[model samples]
Target chain A: MIQRLLLLLFLIVFAVSETADAAVKTIVLDGSTTVGPVAKSFAIYFTKKYGVRVTVSESGSGNGAKSLINSSCTIATMSRAMKEAEIAAARKKGVNPVAHVIAFDGLAMVIHPANPVRSLSISQIRSIYQGTIRNWKEVGGANARIVVIQRESNSGTQESFKELVTGKRMRITGNSETQSSNGAVKNRVSTTLSSIGFLSLGFVDSSVKVIAVNGVVPNEKTVKNGAYKVTRPLYLYTNGQPSGLVKQFIDLPNTPEGKGMITELGLVSR
Target chain B: MNIGTRKILDRSFTAVGIGSIVVMALALMIVVVPIVYNGIGAVFFTGTVEHRKMLHAEFKRGDSQNLDSEVASTDRYRAKVYDMLTGFEAELETMAPEKKTEYTAKYAQVQSALRALLGPLPGDPEPMLTRFKYGQTRWEKAEEKLHDLLYESKWDNSNSSVMSKEFFVSRAISFEGTSLARLFPYVKENLENMLHPEFTFYWGFITDSSVDSHFFGGIWPEIQGTFFLAIGAMLFAFPLGVVAAVYFTEYAKPGFLNSMLRSANSTLAGVPSIVFGMFGLAFFINTMKVSESKSVIAGALTLAIMILPTIIRAAEEAILAVPKTYREASLSLGSSKWNTIATVILPAALPGILTGGVISLGRAAGETAPIIFTAAVSVGSAIGLADVFSSPTPALSWNIYNLASEHEAAAQLRHVQYGMVLALVTIVLLLNLSAIVLRARISKKLKC
Candidate 1:
């Protein structure tokens, strides 16, 4: 009986191993919390269509670059372009950094649904971030302290905001609260009445009011036409040219099904 | 059994007991030593002049005269480094366009590294973020920045079978023939003079509010929030737990109903902490509309329910542990049964009950999951006492998870995370220690 049981266990192990070997094609993408939702949706779609597994990790863009240079991931999804130093580092490791534009995203300035302010000029936003304008009343809103919320320092969204809205030389006030993700910023703004925060356009929902930037509200058309001021392109970086599952996954943005998925996720399709 | 076999069994039993204790001690040390060491770094470290300057500028606590003198001395050494950068910029202007572009990018890296190490360079625009307004605040971080200034870190991935290895190339080598070559060595050598390092006891790490997403400043908000949540849980749970215990021990007779209630209590205790959080969300926040959203009162009630079983169990055991003679003595002295239970029985079991209460307090404070959907937030200042009814706040247990896992700059703020863990562990351990002491005192007083 013991010998028959041993034989049965061996057969089961061999079958499992054979199936695992057959299922070797997998894609790994990591980085950029801003682009995480799109990456996740593509992974789900690709997996469902092609029966290939795809894994995505939402660290910031810097870590994604690091993962690519380290050759740990097949693709690195970033909301921002790779920095020169990061590119050089990847080249040094014999990894040629290539960019694939997946979608366009606008940085939506979000406030509580109860907030009365509809539009804020670029200069007014800068002044509020710079701590010069402390109260909502100072910017045509309610009489409450403007509780500024920002993304953490290493966030790709944070970097883009620094480049576009707040000048690189300007500092966000020390008093402003910092959240980690676009989702977190949305949550904070939606719940807190006297708060203002920024999130990726994909995360914009009815729970929070999206402030018009410089008299233009960010939508798919405005962001795509470059009329929205705080817009950035999302990217998936592959080490050299992607082939097989990686190519198929990255090419999803250009396909009708892929565009539908991207649009469904509230991102501007390429 | 033979005498010899019996002796061997006894010896083996003793060995097993000693071995287990040694293993436990080793395990505790492995976990605690790193926490204590890194936690100490949060408050006590070789702080640079920039640290003093930050304190002076932000909190207005440091001696201005002393700080001014140190800044002046550091600036004297920093002047040469700035001069080298200026020289390199001029040299870049004279080079060919391609050379200028290459050098400019490389030069930008060097300048940012220097800025990170020693704050703003001369002729640089004033920085907007409070982070860039000061240089490396700690000496160890200064060394790390100095290394960055000297070398460009790159990965080597030659073999497909193995992981890539990281190696640093000297930045001086890259700027071999350029004027920028002089900048690396000069900055590397004069770093100490440029950032006067001195040991600092920054007690404010426990008291002051954080700045710039905890890249600077302290964790007082998280600590205070943990206190509020734990205490609030106790305020609701302790009385209810003891009342149920009294009912079970003194009034209720053992039967099917009693057994069913006990089984339900145990079943509630067996439920997962995340389930408790979900229940809190559904029953309190969603269904009952507890302050519209996540609030301290909602969290406290959730935690109260979560810990209620443990508290009831502990109170029952303590009440049972009280000598029956005490009750008899009270009754003989003409006191009614209720009076005996109120004054005599309760006072006798007070320490044991307190011991359980203290443990539950620590458990509530250390818990993260139950409060995640109830009261805890990733980033919020300490709320006023009145705000506990309606507002959410950052608690130590939840923020530790947030800072470690979810913070964008999680890698850069290891000290803060360790400090938080240490703070929580200390709070729980201190509560337990006080309970142990109280029990000892109670035992001694009873003996007398």
Candidate 2:
């Protein structure tokens, strides 16, 4: 009986190895946690239709670009444009990295639902993240401690937020919680009454009230027209020029199905 | 197999042990190596000086071809034909529409003639010729440099550098209309955009903190948060676990209490860290009202509970290993059981207890699941040792998770993260190694 069981196990293992040896394609995406929902939705939607499994991981836009440089992933889901250094690295690896705009994202400044603050200027937001503004009353809210929340270093949303809100030079409050994803931050703020955080427009919901940046609420209309200051393009970076399955994946943003997926996932289609 | 062959075979088998060790080592390496390899470019960060010099070199060499006043630069040649671009770009911000078939004939004529005449310039030559073909501003900026020589009455063929009349026939300097000479200072300064320090490396995001300006200048608060959380966890878990282990092993009833103790320990270990976090959020953070869920106390308390089983097991073994002779002698000398425990047994078991504590510390240093569930705040105030109870602190592990998430910070911190990790591992190793050495010393001193 043991011999027969062993024989069966060997047969199964041999069969599995044979199939594994067959050319299987994997696409890895790492980037903005804010852009994660749309990327994940797209990956699942595309894979089911095309039968090509695509793995999606959100480290931040910079990490996405970094992944492209290291050849760890085929596609990098970025919330920002590539730097000259990243481009040079890709060229070194004989893959001229190209950016494909998958979608447009509007970064939304969020406060706990209890916050009565309606609007803030970029300078005011900068003050909050910079730890200079510690009281909610300073920003037209209750006399409460202003709990500042931030994304982890791998989040593209935070990258764009740094450029727009803080001029990339300010420091966040030291007592910041660094959540790994947009959902994590959003969820924390929703549960914690005194907290404030930011998320991609897709991750915005009723639990957290969206505040206006410079009196502009992030929306499809505002972001599309570039009226929203916290808006940035979502991108996919590949080593060299993308071709074959990779090309098809990159160009998905241009297709009707891809657009549908983006819309369904609550992100603005490029 | 002969004796000589057998000996070689034995040596070969032993060498394969390292291969297994390599596999194990590689397994550990993957968690760090892939990310390190991905972020290696960030380590080669050239200070602002190198970046500035390279840009300066490129800009100077860009115009090296036509030092002569008569040689029409592309920007000057394009400025002569600026009307075509200005009209075409009126429809869209991007020149995508201009790249269509309608502008091709004129585009072809203008491009071919310019490509042949100017040959090439510095920096991204292909984009202007292809992707950004209708981006007349880039050409206009280049052309504005040539605007001086473009439609001049002298029309001396020259390089794009401002005409000092040395490189041209217009030695008299007799231009009446607002000469492009007035704009030379502004244009020369504007050209520096090709090489200006990009603030992206510092700015974490649109809503960046002030630290972005200082190039990740300091993380004293986050460092403080990490230190106190681990210390607090050790403070809370170590004694509780050791006492529980001692009581269970030394004094508990065999039939019911032993079974119950075993079941309790296994169950405690089996419980997911998230459930503990939920419990902490509800009990300590919310009900007890010590601080917010993101406070360091919440994390420390939760992690203490999480690592209790590990501490208990290690302590139990250590306590059991204590020689019975010491306890017997203490009892025979009219000492109470509690007295013996406090004096003899506890002192002898101190090294084992320390080992258990350090092992728990190492686990706490790397644990994400419990912290993620507990007091981890996305952003918190600057916490310090004094603020350990009230403030939210980001630990080393969480910092890595955070660093890998923010693109701007990640771009700049790849090396810092590795260095930070190296530091964290070194500290943990030191703590564990010290415990090990102390264990050895105590064992020798006690002659156990």
DockQ, per model, reads 0.02, 0.02
Per-residue lDDT tens digits for candidate 2, residues B235-353, read 79988998898888788878976898788997998888778877876677546766522467878998999899988988888889888998999999999988999899988987787
Please provide, for model 1 over B1-448, each residue's C-alpha lDDT reduced to its tens digit, 9 standing for 90 to 100: 9999999999999999999999999999999999999998899999999999999987898889988998889888988888888888888889999988998898988988888898888777665345667999999999998998899866454442332345789999999998779888888777889888999999999987676547788888788778778878988999999999999999999999999999998898789999999898778876787654467898999999999999998999999999999998899999998999999888788878878987998899999999876787554444556566666667899878767655544556789899999999998998788778777887677678
Worst 10 residues of 1 chain A by lDDT: A15-24
Against the unseen true structure, what C-alpha lDDT does each candidate score? 0.81, 0.60
Identify the candidate with maximal lDDT.
1
Q: List pairs with backbone clashes in candidate 1.
A: A171-B128, A171-B129
Candidate 1 residue runs with Cα over 4 Å from true position: A1-270, B157-164, B332-334
lDDT by residue for model 1 (A145-238), tens: 9999998876888888988999878889998999877767876776787899998888776567898999999999999999999999999999
**What are the runs in model 2 whose C-alpha is more than 4 Å off?**
A1-270, B1-16, B26-45, B49-210, B213-215, B406-413
- Top model by TM-score, which number? 1
lDDT of 1 at A123: 96
Which of the CAPRI classes, incorrect, acceptable, medium or high, describes model 2?
Answer: incorrect
Residue-level lDDT of model 2, residues A1-270, one tens digit each, is 223533664464344334322224545566566666566556655555676645454546776676566554577778878878778877786657777888988888887655557689988888888888898777766677878898876567777888877877777778778876776777778778678898888777655789888989888889889888888888877776788988888888788867766765557887
